[model samples]
Target: MVSIDEVARAAGVSTATVSRALSGRGQVSAGTRSRVLDTAAALGYVVSAPASSLASGRARNIGVLLPVVDRWYFSTVLAGIASGLQSAGYDITLYALTEDPTERAVVFETFLRRRRVDGVIAIAMSLDTAEADRLAALGMPVVALGAEHRQLPSLAVDDIAVAKLATAHLTDLGHRELAHIGILHDVDDGTEREHIPSLRRRGFEQALDAAGIPRTSARHEHGDFTIEGGHAAAMRLLTGDAPPTAIFAASDEMAFGALIAARDLGLSVPGELSVVGVDGHELSGFFGLTTVDQFPHDQGLRAAREVLAALDEPAPPTTPETGPAGLDPLPFDLVVRTSTRPPRRES
Candidate 1:
């Protein structure tokens, strides 16, 4: 295997300089850094984790713990994190804990505690106090994405406020009877069933109450966070005796399903019922669903950056504080389209 020394010799720089250049740390001149990188690339030189750790006291990799790899939001966030970490000269190790208790235990108790990564970035998983304690015991910096952790630094949007914003948009259109389609996930994944749905539901209720509309239990239905689930739930809701004039889905996928349900029921969208969704999914524009754009990709990028920042510190805090991590809330914009309008009177 091509060693760092060989690359350093080929680039006419010292081994220390090669390390600095390849790691993008310390004081390496741009010209020398470029030369070292070019030589290493040409020689197929891969950095030795053991050697690098000996020198820098860090593994130069970050662990990204996610609930599922197949989901769109998770994958998009992972892409952003990977991009940001790569730019910062760090490697990412992905761990998917798909609701298996044993696997989750192994990951938290063994793999994470093994010092394989300098820090961790948990996406969309709400760590319980025990899990948070385990991570804290590892003495590495940890940052959470899409969920708040008062005991550790976290980056997330205020879900409740976003829900209120979405619901308010429909109410402003003079929608008196509105319905909400929410996702029901396992509590372990820390979304939908964990906190997002409840917070969003509360926000929806608050918005309706503020508008002097009665918040009835009949207006809500829970389903998985998939388009099919939304479709099924919405079909049932719309077919009921009292159909709502507007539907506020917690996610774009669900909103798409609501649209499908509306079509299947022979209802004219925005004429018979208006629909709104959250998450700004890429396909929202194609369907023309009015939505609250919560930049998930940007959220991932910010979470990765926070991990890098903690890694860069001279001495990371051993005891994680239960306080705001000073991360800015990602901006949200309401994208209006043909899917939403004021209620039309029946002829």
Candidate 2:
């Protein structure tokens, strides 16, 4: 019912000053900004996004790309990004890159190229060299989350190191016969084992080697990064002739599955089989699961910060932090709980 002009008239400020104050963009004195805001609030006046875009040459919207929106990691990161962007007065446009290659192609070739957003933040999607070039060609700042891109600003944890730490925790607890539940694309879930999962597998193997434990093929199972997948994998391993004393799941979801499977098999946790996982999943505490806490939400916040900084600067954005062994790997911690302990002595 009201407009910017009415608010500007009430506040005794120019329309441009009202715009600057409302958008928090250009120079406006504190007193003027306060008055303008009060007037706009009193008058129920709202700034038009289209008009603002036309005037500032910015959409004030950031595009976010994710492989799947249903997963815990993806959803949690999105929540963080949403809160951070809202506080900074920016909007978000989400693009869910489906499993189909054609669908993903459409997102990059069409959706992202529409010139509607000022920046992009992609989460753990396997963007190849060509895809990365296409994103860069958009001429907008792009930041990658949970994966490293040499050309884009990124935030990622050292998956290999985190995995090794999880495995080492089990080994230090006298888990000589240990197994790992990891992601494998050949499975029904069609999970990808390119970046984080693959790196974690390598770390698991390295830890086993360092502990002088044999890295047997029998000790590995592809869980597809899901609780159900981990349950199935644990079912098979636990029923085997020589079951492992402990299991290291690449993700907390899988570890939760392993815990369930152990319980189903009448095996006592930490007493019969120790389990450990990565990701500080919300349910981890309730489950009393020992885990490596990779703060996905924080990664989202950092990625948003990087995008905002790039958008504010006149120059090109700074190079992103790479991972697996970055100069500064994203923060992570090993949380010990009831799920893991030194393997029970063989009577």
Candidate 3:
């Protein structure tokens, strides 16, 4: 098999020059770098991660923690992080914290403490005070994805503003009766699922108030962030005595369920009821659902970059700060589609 030494010999360069050129680090003449790369590619030479890590005294790996891997949003973010890290010559180790609290404890108490990774990126999993402290005490750089930590850096979207924009979109379309389907978790989704709901719910109510529409308890229902849950919730809401003219699902998956529910009830989309959702899910375009695009993949990429920066510095916190810690709120865009339109008047 071809090796770095062979590539260096063939390229007529020293081993140090070959290393610098192949790794794209240090200074090397452009001509020499090109020759080394051509020689290595022709010989099918591959760089050894272990050797590189050993030489640099760094693992060259980043640890990513996610509550669940099957979820679309989290998995999309993970993919973005993986792609970004891979492009930057870093490897990823994923730690899935299922519903087991003990496993989560082990991750915080032991796995992260082992110093096996240069940095840690957490996705949507809110670390408790103790867990945050324990990880912080490790002194490794930490970046939170989609959730904010006071001590760590994070990337996410403004949930309240997203809700307001979605609600306002429906209100502007002449829909006075509207409903919101949001996640209700027994445990928080780690990003103020507990607090964000209240804020977004308030935003929804505020939009209604501004439009001179009365806020009613009947207009609110909580889903489990799943299509089936959304279908069930929307089924109940739509079948009620006074059905809403439009529905704003907190996520595209739920909005998809609502779409299905609308179909099952013999209702015509936009003609009978309008639907909107957040989280620019890939399928949203296919489903023709109007939505607020939160760009979760970009959030993950930004969070990974932040983690890399923190790992490069590893600074200590000195002062108490106000507001959400580690929170880098990403932007959102309202994407209109065929799913939403003016409320229909009785023919």
lDDT for each of the candidates? 0.84, 0.86, 0.82
lDDT of 2 by residue, 23-105 (tens): 88889999999999988988888778899899888898999999889999999999989888888878999998877879878
lDDT score, candidate 1, position 207: 93
Best by lDDT: 2
TM-score of each: 0.90, 0.92, 0.90
Off by over 4 Å in 1: 41-44, 183-194, 314-326
Off by over 4 Å in 2: 184-194, 314-328
What's the best-to-worst order under lDDT?
Answer: 2, 1, 3
Query: Compared to the true structure, candidate 1 yields what TM-score?
Result: 0.90
Q: Which pairs clash in model 2?
A: 153-320
Estimate the Cα RMSD of every predicted model relative to the unseen true structure.
Answer: 2.9, 3.4, 2.6
Ranking 2 against 3 by TM-score, winner:
2
Candidate 1 lDDT over residue span 33-89, tens digit each: 889988999999998878888888888899999988988889889888988999877
TM-score of 3: 0.90
